[model samples]
Target: MSFISIKNVWKYYDDNLVLERLNLDVEQGEFVSMVGASGCGKSTFLNMLLGRELPTKGTIVLDGETLKDEPNADRGIVFQKYSVFPHLTVLQNVMIADEFSSAKVLGWTFGNNKKLIKEKALEFIQAVGLTPAVAKYPHELSGGMQQRLAIAQALMKAPKVLLLDEPFGALDPGIRNDMHELIHDVWQKNKLTIFMVTHDIKEGFELGSRLWVFDKLRDDPQAPNAYGAQVTFDLPLAERVNKNNVNEIIEKVSRN
Candidate 1:
């Protein structure tokens, strides 16, 4: 079975259908990048994967079992806005994520495991190239640095799946490139499945081995809410043309 599966899924907010007849199979440790226009159900898709929302029809399965309607430690998420605590130091933020997850699973504080927590937190901080900023507060760090913290905090829990919602969308060009490398590096070492949502097709194609393009392909003018977004293409980058050609392919996909 696929590590993550979405079969005949449809999502609707009240009467507004957002995603329709969506089926996907994500292998473990594969990076799947998603691209689409705004309000095209990308965020809704991620929310469903993370178990924050359930599909109105069909199933979302992980490891043969259907998902529950609540967030769990098996999945970690990082948004465009840093979700780190403003009052906590970088190290503390990373430490708490691990503690929180463990507390949920073990039904007790990992407080006794503080010594190990500090060690693991530091390891993830350095993994994201933030060893120096460990002592600084969130506000004390630059935007890129804060993002690094967010990545570290998420991965510190060692989640099976990581969901990134345009985590680098707000960064400067230089910093965005840096984050791309950091994310790839962490993905390599952590061996976690990833589903990232991005507006930039170049970024999507660059980051993932499999690319899923989402767009509204069919609509009725009389009833705009009746139709919903669906995958236009699922392009595997393992055997493909060069970078420019790959971008060209996605450009064509986006246009159609």
Candidate 2:
């Protein structure tokens, strides 16, 4: 069975339809990447998966149960911008996840398991290559280091599913390359189910085991906003296809 099932979903903003009849089945531990033209409902789909938005029609299921439509420890997300708190040090940023989540679930105080959580935070921080910056505040770090801290923060709960939205888009090409490697290792080590949304076709194809191209199937120049997008192309990189062929296929299908 699919770990994440999105069945016949549609999204509407008042009279405007953003997504129409979308369906997908994402297996556990699969790394899926998505690409689409801007305003093609890519972010909307991610938000729905994150439980930040509800679909206008149809249902989404996770682990054979209907989605809770609320944020929790089951899923985590990282974005392109500053994802850490400027006022907190890196260790505090990581530790806060344990602090809040435990409080919510166990009615716990910081005194409970303080040493264990700190060690886990530090371990994850070091894993992300941010050990030296443990005591530093977010504002004092470089863009790359700040993003690393964000990643550690997101993984604090050991969520089963990880969602990334243009996570390295703001970094330099060199730094972005480093992040790509980091995330690849993190995914393998944790066996995480990941879904990333990227505008860079190469990066999307390079990172994902499976690629999902979202684009409008029909276009009306006279009424551009009337139609919506779907998963026009779903391909597995493990198949017998080269990068050039994959790129050509994505380019061909992404046209509105």
Candidate 3:
């Protein structure tokens, strides 16, 4: 079996069918991006992979096991909005995440274990080029830096899968590009499996080793009011053309 598999998955909200018969297989250590317009079920899919939401009809498997009731430490999530504790310094933010992942509640109690967590947190902070800002609180940093801190907190857990839900969407273009570069570097260094949901088409093409487009269709009988969305295309990064060809591909897919 693939490292992560979604077999004929279907999702619904009350009577609205959001996704239908979606199947995907993600290899270990691969970076995949899911892209579409807003309310296209990208976040829902990410939640499913994180075990926060169950598919209405089908199954999702991670590392050969089915998703459980609660999210495990094996998967790390970074959302667009900064979820860091404003009261905590950058170092504290990361250290707390490590402690929680390690199942240690005494994160504030200074000791050998706490020191080790501190060291690990610092290591990740430096990895994301935030060592100098580690002493500052989230309020003291710029928006981009806060996002970087959030990324560091997620990576500190050493999760087997990293799920990013438009983590850089709120940043300016320059900062967003920088975050993308940082994400690329971190993925290369750690070979972590990533499943990202983004609306930026360029970002999706740039970061994804494989790309999946979720498109809604009204032709299906099962989906009339809220037609079940379909997986229109899946392609490797190498095969995907640049901006010049992307429009053509999109146009072709839309016509179908």
Candidate that would win on TM-score: 1
For 214-242, candidate 2 gives per-residue lDDT tens digits of: 88888889887788888888989774358
lDDT (CA) per prediction: 0.88, 0.87, 0.85
Q: Give the TM-score of candidate 3.
A: 0.91
- Full candidate order by TM-score, most accurate first: 1, 2, 3
Which 10 consecutive positions of candidate 1 have the poorest summed lDDT? Answer: 103-112
Candidate 3 regions exceeding 4 Å error are 101-107, 219-226, 239-247, 250-256
What lDDT is reached at residue 21 by model 2? 89
Clashes of 1: 0
lDDT of 1 by residue, 13-113 (tens): 89999999998898998899999888999999999999999999999999788998998888899999989999889988989866665677753354558
Clashing pairs in 2: none
Question: What lDDT, from 0 to 1, does candidate 2 have?
Answer: 0.87
Best by lDDT: 1
TM-score for candidate 1, please give it. 0.94
Itemize residue pairs with steric clashes in candidate 3: none
After superposition, the stretches of candidate 2 with alpha carbons farther than 4 Å from their true spots are 104-112, 239-247, 250-256
Show the lowest summed lDDT stretch of 10 residues, model 2: 103-112
